[model samples]
Target chain A: MKYISEYRDRQVIDRLAGQIASFRDTKAVFMEVCGTHTMSIHRFDIPSLLPAGLRLLSGPGCPVCVTPVGYMDHAIALARQGKHIIATFGDLVRVPGSTSTLEKARAEGADVRTVYSITEALELARTHPGRKVIFLAIGFETTAPATAAGVLQAQKEQLRNFCILSAHKVMPPALEMLASEGVKIDGYLCPGHVSVITGEEIYRFIPRKYGVGCVIAGFEPADILLAILLLLKQVTDGKPRVENAYKRAVRKEGNPKAREMMESVFRPVDTEWRGLGMVKKSGLVLREEFASMDAAGQIRVMVEPPVEPQGCICGQILKGIAAPSDCPLFGKMCHPGNPVGACMVSSEGTCQNAFKFQSDG
Target chain B: MDELIMMAHGSGGKKMHELIRNLFVKYFRNPFLESGGDAAVVPPEPGHIAFTTDSYVVDPLFFPGGDIGKLAVSGTINDLAVSGAAPRYISAGFIIEEGFPVKDLESVVRSMAGTAKQAGVQIVAGDTKVVNKGKCDRLFVNTSGVGIISEKHTHIATADHVKAGDQVIISGYVGDHGMAVLSQREGFPVKTGLKSDCTPLNDLIGKVLERFDHVHFMRDPTRGGVATALCELAEGRQFGVLIKEPAIPVREEVMGLSEMFGFDPLYVPCEGRVLIVADQSVSQGILHTLHGHPDGENAAVIGEITTGNWGKVVLETIAGGRRIIHMLTGEQLPRIC
Candidate 1:
């Protein structure tokens, strides 16, 4: 609690809040592009601290929320085959596919395991050599390096039974698409963990081409407040530029070794997002050298046609054009227990966070 | 003698008799159990009584601070304690998988007897069943307890007397038992030296009830934790509960591990702690009594019942912000990041 509690100091947060509240009035709408940021914002009840003119919107940052239903069907297809073990992040197991979820499949006797890291998935393969183990690799750049490292470890060990179903995505392409699609936004609060790997420099293009302010932020209350204050200052001064508010973790150049490792194992390709359809060079797949370790190339299964849930406006919510409350099925038919969309499944999802932490007061 | 539990052990044959005499009786010897009857015939008590039962199926039967046996006994006793009763007798049942180590079974039974004796409760009756391999986990335990409560303390059990301005007091820290079990299961190899707070709270609760006259309600924050318990207390009620975030006590290790796993300590479980709601005037006296007990040394006033925000539990965050704490919907999953 040393580093964490210090950042949550009441006096420091109050002083920063007072500064933001007293700053010159500017009508600005900033979007935070990370699921953790969305959770932190609500957990701290940050909306009450901001000025009436300033608004913050959630972006397509949750990897679980962005993963397409087709990918889920493909994974379920593999699980139903009874020849492979599906290892995935815990939240993905509850995501509803075209027909069923991985959780339901598991309840009916499929070998689906939730792991904290890819290393545990590889370990399963090492122990259960007779069965194929597929790691459902899904995340932004913050998690890609670990998946890349896992693939390399598998190759070095010549793990014939281990492979990965890569749904990994990069942040820049999604941001580029959001900006080019003409979504209204005055600034962006970049993800802290992703920025730690991709560095603050990757966001330079946003301010250069679109003239939007970008600030890399940590997930603490003080860190988020400071980022918002900086963005307000940028909007008031009419100087749109990239800034690093989370100096403790993020660097300008980022971690070179992790980026190199990811590049060596994966190559960029256009992929489908649940809400935002195919963006150019947004997805990562295993390179030709590691093709044997790719589950998509190693296994084939029959998948039904993907179908979207009826009256679910998750697509509009992800594009930041609609609030979760704007959807017809917001709380009536889309509660967390019986989630109709991916956004209601993951804890970091905008709707789920709002449902769990938001108050009428 | 066979070094493992075989199918014949559950067949009620000579092996079963030998097991009863060699393990269960050796550890759980009492006048009622020595009769070898089908049920425990307890002496009649002359007051209102509390009866409760609980089942334990925790993975890795043996954890940092306690094992399945200790947990089974402590859980049942705590249930009766929170009802403002003095636990007097308990019954244990075991469903074990075939081929389990005889030494492990012996140790589990021994632990149960040890915990029962320490709490001054007699293990009056018991049953054991063995299933085939893979039919069950290594072991499972169920315990039922009975206790007596005086007429003066009976009002504390129904919780209808709770009113506005009643203070909420919690015993010690939260999330210790939950974090301990999770870390052991994940094999995180974290050197936090974390351990479960799995112990009986009957003595602590009994002392406070004896000293305080305005005690209105009591509950052990078990599976769903303090947050869920508070939510349940506020649901369908005429008033609400407002808790201060910083007032909730949490250990550094629990906080750190929860942060690493993307879990909130508020939603995690606590096995050995109690949450008491009482009148505002006697709150200082109750806190003084709780702090004098070993299990309640870190007691603090966390919140109070309120009139506004009916049927909702709101938290005043570390910063000057507030949010509602809802009942936990499902198992909290580890985050992708």
Candidate 2:
């Protein structure tokens, strides 16, 4: 815990809190574009230490929360076919599809399993040679590289039974969409893990085009408080720039090997986000060379048109226009145990994080 | 073929009798079980007795610190000990899958015998059954225990005497047992030197109970970790509990692994730890006594009960902020990053 404990030091955190409070009179709103950041902000109770004028909004950073309903419907349709084994992240098991969820599909005799990584799914394909294994590949750039590696591994092994249902997305195009939509925002608290792979330079366009301050932050209390302090300084000085506050893990050049792996297997395609609709070149699909490893190309199933749940404002919440509390079904009809919306499903989703960790009576 | 267990071993024939005599009775030898009756008959006790049961189905059967056998016995003993009783007798039942190695089964039985002997508890009765392959996870153990509660220690069970100004104490590091098992699970990539804190806590609890009459409540933080245990304690109550985040004791490996997996150490399980609620006057004395024992060497006062915020458990975060501790509603899933 050497590196982690220092970041969580009480003395350092209290001093940063004091410094953040010194700019209490300044008015600004900063958006954090990562699900892990949203979870950390609430887990550390960072908002309690911040000034009232300085507000933090959760953006569409949670990949599970941003995935469109049609995507889940297709996955469920494949699960119902009873010929393939569906491997997915744990949170996706509970995410509600149009008609049923993967959890329900599993209980009713679907071969669905939760894996910690894509490597585990690949191992399943290696062992269960008789059954086809489909990995539900969904996440930001931080996880896309691993899926890409899984694809390359399958190709090398000639594992025809393994394929990926890719729903991977990039961060920069989504940020551009947010700016183009003219959402109110002063600055952005860039994601730490995603920035580690894509590098700090990818966010330079935000400052040049929109004149908004950007600070890449780590997922600790002191790191976030320091990021807020830096953003406040930028707003006061009227100088907007993409600064790397989490230099310990994030580099300006980013991780080249991971980017290379991702580029080899996937190509950009316009995809649908739950709230943001379709953004050009935002999603990743398997390239033509690796098309045989794509689940969509190998399997064909009929799925009904997707339907959104009624009285669910997850769309507005993911867009950072409203809070989870603004929804009427937040705590009453929806909860972590029986989530009614996608935002309430994943532990990192804004609504789920707020419901589980936020200190409100 | 005889090296592995077969269905005939549970058929109540020659194989069944041979397994019972060679495996179970050889290790868990006791007078009550030697009688070979349908029920264990013991002398009548004068004091109130506590009865508790637990089931152990942990995956990977054996890990760095302990196995399912150790977990089953320790879990039952801790349950009775936390209720302010001296655990005296236990009954073990096993449902093992067919084709399991006989040597592995003997190793688990030996572990159980060793742990029970160290705790001075008798395994008075037993039963075994073998199912088809894949019916059970390799094995499952269920243990029921009986313990006698002295008159003076009965107050710990009711917890009615607990009031404001009382202190909360945790015996040792949290999340060791959980992370130890998690790091060694089948599909995980990381391997570490972490060991599970899976040991009997009866000696530690008995010492503290004998020395302090003001110990109002005691509970083992097993599943759902410290946060869930504390939340259950404060639920539907007239008082609130406030705990300092930095004061809680956690190991470096546990903290590191939990951070790596995106799991919170506060919500993981600790097998060999106890949470005590005692009056302010005897809080220091209890800590002093707990620290003297090897199991309680890292004991510390973590929090105190307050007169406000009815039924709420609040934590003073490391950053000088506060958050409510809610009961764990679902499994703690590893984040997708």
Candidate 3:
């Protein structure tokens, strides 16, 4: 890979590691805000190699882990009804709802699926016109364009049978909530793919007001190390700034067209985060302009106040105060094959990342 | 004979024969080919035989560059090529639905014939069975090919042949076929500018094989990208594969779509591209020759085989990061979410 390989020089890693060892600032908690980075760190066993005292705490990075209890309940409710086939990404199916997860509902004969793209849900609706194919939409900005595309596509095809129960959330508001939570964060590692579309501008709020250094980085070890080094410089110098370590892909302004598409389709709305309380304007709602594509808009959703299973601290886990292992059900009750929380369901989730890579969780 | 097998035609009998004779044989007539024995006895040859089978269920059966028919034949032949073989003959099997249009079938068959001709292979035999509608996804075609492995060092093992410094070479562009299929399927069809690179690489592989005696192993990164292919090649050898993401060839649209879909193009399937493992010391001349060939024009040394935790593949991403590639346990694209 052109811009990719030269930076992965092992000699560079050793040199950088040596440089970091020379400084040896152990008290700072370098929080990686992106779930991808959290998983990447564990998958590569990065923490073990880091100099002692440089703690890497996972922020509320996993979008799936942050998905509130109500969303899963609503999806499972729709799935169990058997009238509509609930199509969603792999993340949602295993997340525990109030009664059961979508996987359980599916085994009990609900037409639940783990789709790769929202467009695939449109295809299912197109193929099986008789069935109401509702998509269980979730994710941050990077994944929103596809759902937005699905809405436009459904409208174009006049797919009355297809609709979306949206739970897509935005990142900036969530980051603000994290900063508000008083989580000890000396720096922030931004998501690469998200930054590519969102640019590095929206994240300026975090460093300016909060005094935490933020680096928009690619999800690579070298990229991560560079972001950490930048954060370290900020911490040591007592200066707060936003830097772009992944400039090859991410631009300063991000992809305006994609952002426009997303904004045009979805509006900022108050949404419930599983562990994090309902952060205002964190969720994406179908714009009144595209209300017809929204399942929430089309039908009278008599959803009860969302409830969670007893003792599942998915919300606390999302805030980085507790790890997945800290939860009583981490492995015993919340295995990937059987999940008790939404966090354990998605691969990009904190719990799933912990389960798959950080088994200590 | 008896006005014969309708779709009841293929319910296991002579009626099926009549249907085949009238609809299929009438179009695909060949003098040396017939399909009625326990197994067709092919001519014996001195060189080892390279055999491969692929079951294609690609939707939008007819896409920009190819259809299910072309996909079946071309895919199997490509597999043979990656095995250091000169593809010779292919046998196609179609699990078609009953209500399928004769015109559609004609177009598909004609396409298969054209693709077979382009690959320099003959469809020597075939079997057809039609199930009821709503059962099959349009038409599912499975093809198996037999080719002559003429390379003297044909006893290739991805693990056995690879060393710490062995170079990784890709035949050409990656993710073309996967992205092309995705574009049309999602209804955001952009005039279908892309074509499936569903061409056979038998001759191209033969060319590389002739000049390079140190060519360790070759594989078409079909369903699992170069990452999975390398993982398989590195099996039992306890060696790791290091890939430079920038060196991996991916088209702009593919790169954009990958970003949109949150997928690694390296894990997405491709039917045309091949990954070659060769000692890095001996790779310059092979890469030059590959660069000359039209099919391998975009070829580049994406990575190198290394002696490390064997059977592991490390992708040194463009962002100056590394990710150890895991063989995806399941298919790339699922129904929907």
Candidate 4:
């Protein structure tokens, strides 16, 4: 609370709001890459405090929202097999994969489980020596290290039953994908949790290569407001710099040990994103040295890269070009209770975020 | 051994003491447990004390907004705080499964320490019991609290004091704590990056209690969210309550998560936040004070207690349509605190 509470002061917000008001040139779009920032801005009515010219958009920082249809199809394949338990992070449990969710699979009597960490799945393999335990390793860099660590542990333990659905994604490639797609992102509010692991330098590539001003921001209202102010100044000055606005938690290089653990066990590969097509070096896979931990690659499961659902605009929503309301079935046809798209299934999904908060614009 | 919780662990046998010493007494060892008693006796406290006891067995011991430990402490303290009491003391009881991981138990206990430390309450007493894994879902924590109600403050517990013109103000966002717990517990991918807003609301209450004379009623919206809390205040009386959906501070994450899981935040649980119905004159003063506090930073004016559907909660939407804010039929996500 000490580190977090002081940063959310109201007096500072008042000062920052005035600063934001004075800085507006034209109605500009500032895209926050983290789902937390998106919610924080909406939670405290931070947008109302800002000048009407400052338009904030949510980008694809949500891992669950970006996970391709193919990955969910793969999970569905394993779940339908009923031979192994498909263990995954709690966040991935409700995401509507190509045909069904892990929860639906479980309801249909598939051996699906929700785990807090990859290690919980690893322990399951240890406990149930006979049954195959395939951990669904889906996340960005912040969570990839934990899955990689779990893989390393599995190989060391010689757990034959333990394997991983390696769908871990990286940030930079996706940012490149977003920028080159021409989404009109004036600036970026980078992810706090991922920056803690990848450091501030990972984002430097974005501004240097694509010319988008980026700010590594915290999740509080003040933090986001400060990041927006910094971005506005950068945009106004025609500067493209990756600034570390979350210095309290993030460092220049990030967590070295976490990087090393991921590097040692996993290698970057081309992986498909939900909205964006496959990008090279965007996903982490268990190295050849740790092939035994690779379930899909090892078992040689030919899971065709599944197609995105017919009407789901999750891809467009993820690109910040479209809101959840853009879809014909925002609340009418695709409510959270009965999701129609991947974006509608996850809380971090832009559509769901918009739907829940009712921010139609 | 894993099927049923055998009585040997609770029979005061070697296994019983081992279960106590190794597990229960291990995480919860305090002056009370160290005192060795059937029920620990209270020492002493200041004048006109307020004590409230609550047993939380909400399934999914861990939820999006909080776990049983956070709920246990916050729930107990909120009960006292709404009754015009300043929380000072607390006691906890954990009903754990036999094979419940010691580490998980420790994490919940550590969370309790965090909540207690923030609330300025001491864990004066506690007890632990281990049922079989099949008998219980990991853990369930029951907590009781004690607080000192200042003599100068009028009791704001009952709704009979709430007038037709009283203004209803809410601290922070609605359905945040509930959506967080539901999304996390159900593992819905709408990862809102929103953690449970579980904290002590005593600070906000202190600010309001210290200010004006017209502070009428207060309650922490927990299970069934603001709708149920409002309905409780509306029972028997014929006061109409109209709230604007746009006016309420609902986080996009809660909405997103609720949309993803088909949950209604109006029926979701809130932990660190509170709902206050006060005189129109004092509403601004209370909001200002709450905004100053860490826990109540997101406070907003949601609606008011008016005089038509006295028992029902009505929500006015952005489109000028009205919908009844009703009590929860079923938990959007079970086992969430």
Give model 1's TM-score for chain A to 2 decimal places: 0.99
Candidate 3 error regions (>4 Å): A1-27, A32-56, A85-182, A189-234, A239-272, A277-317, A321-347, A350-361, B1-19, B26-29, B34-39, B157-159, B189-192, B334-337
**Candidate 2 per-residue C-alpha lDDT over B1-337 given as tens digits, one digit per residue, 9 for 90 to 100:** 2699999988889998999899999999999999999999999887899999988888778998999999889999999999999999999999989999989999999999999998989999999999999999788889999999998888887777779999999999988888888887878878899988988889999998878788989988888889999998999889999998899999988888887777888888988999999999999999999889999999999999989878888988887778888888877622100
- Among these predictions, the greatest DockQ belongs to 1
Question: Alpha carbon lDDT of residue A259, candidate 3?
Answer: 93
What is the per-residue lDDT of model 1 for residues B1-337, given as tens digits with 9 covering 90 to 100? Answer: 7799988888899999999999999999999999999998988988898999988898778888888888899999999999899999999998989999999999999999998998889999898899999999888888999999998889777888889999999998998988887777754546567888989889899889888888999998887789998998889999999999889999999989987878888888888999999999999999999899889999999999999989999998887789999998877622100
What is the DockQ (computed on Cα atoms) for candidate 3? 0.07
How do the residues A19-122 of candidate 1 rate in per-residue lDDT, one tens digit apiece? 99986467899999899999999888988888889999999999999999999999999998987999998999999998899999999899999888998999
Q: Model 2 segments beyond 4 Å from truth?
A: B333-337
- Across residues A1-361, which tens digit of lDDT does each residue of candidate 2 receive? 6677788998999899899889989999999999989998998899998888999999999999999989999999999999899999988998999989998999999999889899999999999999999999999999999999999999999999999999999999989888778888889999999999999889999989998899999998989999999999999999999999999999899999999999999999999988888989999999999988888998999987999999999999988999999999998899998898999998889999888886732
Candidate number achieving the greatest TM-score relative to the actual structure: 1
**How would the docking of model 4 be graded?**
incorrect
DockQ of each: 0.65, 0.60, 0.07, 0.05
Global lDDT of model 1: 0.91
lDDT of 3 at A30: 77
TM-score of chain A of each: 0.99, 0.99, 0.93, 0.94
lDDT of 3 by residue, B79-99 (tens): 787777788888878887777
lDDT of each: 0.91, 0.90, 0.76, 0.76
Worst 10 residues of 2 chain B by lDDT: B328-337
TM-score of 1: 0.98
